[model samples]
Target: MLEPIGQATAAAQNIWGDATQWGVGTGVGTVSGGFEFPSVEEIDAVLSSWRARQASIAQRGNTLELMVSSLTQQPAEDDATTGYIATWAQSLTQLRDQHRSMLEYIEDYIKKLEAAKQAKQAGEAENEAAVQKTAGDLAQ
Candidate 1:
């Protein structure tokens, strides 16, 4: 019934609220002003968490799709019932799309995190090389 769909919509809103809590990194690899970039391992862990969240969104989307399918497949006996079913289906479809959007957002964030991790590692290697070069010059 429409009541159950209403409950599902509330659940989706909670999931979206949780998604907004994630802090997108501020200028990945920016070393100015002493911004401490996360370590590669730390980034990896964050990426893992985001991936898990993405999976959860995907699962919720699947559920919404199933509900929509069930509502749409039912044979409505009257104009009133048809109208109610149509409304429920429309709402569920929109919620499912929102879930898909969240999944995409999380995926994009994961890619950015991976890129930042790589950049940080590269910077560390460059710093180490410079230190060794300076030390060698001093030894001569």
Candidate 2:
């Protein structure tokens, strides 16, 4: 009975080891199948697309900031002379609120992008460390 149990355990271990090996092989094959270096033209196209998007966002934000600043800086037109002054005041308030909201959104987006970039960098570092460890083990 003990001998049979030992054989079963060994069989189970062998099955588990084989499964692990196959899983690793499948993962490597999948990654290699998908991996390709982008041509310089493709790289430039992607970079230009991103740069244009960045520039557009920056220009919009700057325009909003400038409008808000200009509105806030101007002296109030005398209310007694014209109710246009009151209307201007109300419009200025709305503009300020919109600008503030947009600025907040831009700030949040920047922070999120930074966090994602940092996470990618950290993951690459971890992968490098793992590769180095495997290389050292193989050397020994």
Candidate 3:
């Protein structure tokens, strides 16, 4: 009977590797350096930072939404000052909606990065196992 070897495919996107320092920026678990493939740790760190930022931005969006909700209840008087405040509220609403959309993008990208890492790590392990099995079978 052939025994199944372990696979590390789940660790494919672990880009941070053994590096002591990570670069500054939002990395989506992909090799942004082009010249060098990032370690899983590096990618994970970036994702974590991005998620934290997203949460913060989401809270800001909620606050903006609340401001819009409250300000919209007031009647826009004919005076320029009142109209300007109303316009500001409307702009805040637009900004909040945009932030929501941006959050979706960040979430989707993070998922992709995780999957990629897994596939890569697993694939490599799978190949190595196959090679070892073949050699063992030949020796048997």
lDDT of the candidates, in the order given: 0.76, 0.57, 0.68
Whole-structure CA lDDT of model 2: 0.57
Candidate 1 structure quality by residue, lDDT tens digits, 38-120: 57788788878888888887888877877877884657589888888888888888888888888888888888788877888
Cα RMSD (Å) per model? 10.2, 18.0, 13.7
Highest lDDT: give the candidate number.
Answer: 1
Q: Please report how far candidate 2 places residue 59 from its true position, in Å.
A: 8.2
Q: TM-scores of all models?
A: 0.70, 0.45, 0.58
Better candidate number, 1 or 3, judged by TM-score? 1
Model 3 over residues 1-140: C-alpha lDDT tens digits? Answer: 22333444324325434233534443334465322225656667776887898788778877777777777565656688687886887788788778888989988977866775675567668878999999999999
Who is ahead in lDDT, 1 or 3?
1
Query: What TM-score does model 1 achieve against the real structure?
Result: 0.70
| TM-score of structure candidate 3 | 0.58
Residue 9, candidate 2: C-alpha displacement in angstroms: 58
In candidate 2, the residue pairs with backbone N, CA or C atoms under 3 Å apart (3 or more residues apart, or in different chains) clash, namely none
Model 2 quality (TM-score) = 0.45
- lDDT, candidate 2, 78-116, per-residue tens: 666356655666776687677667656766655544444
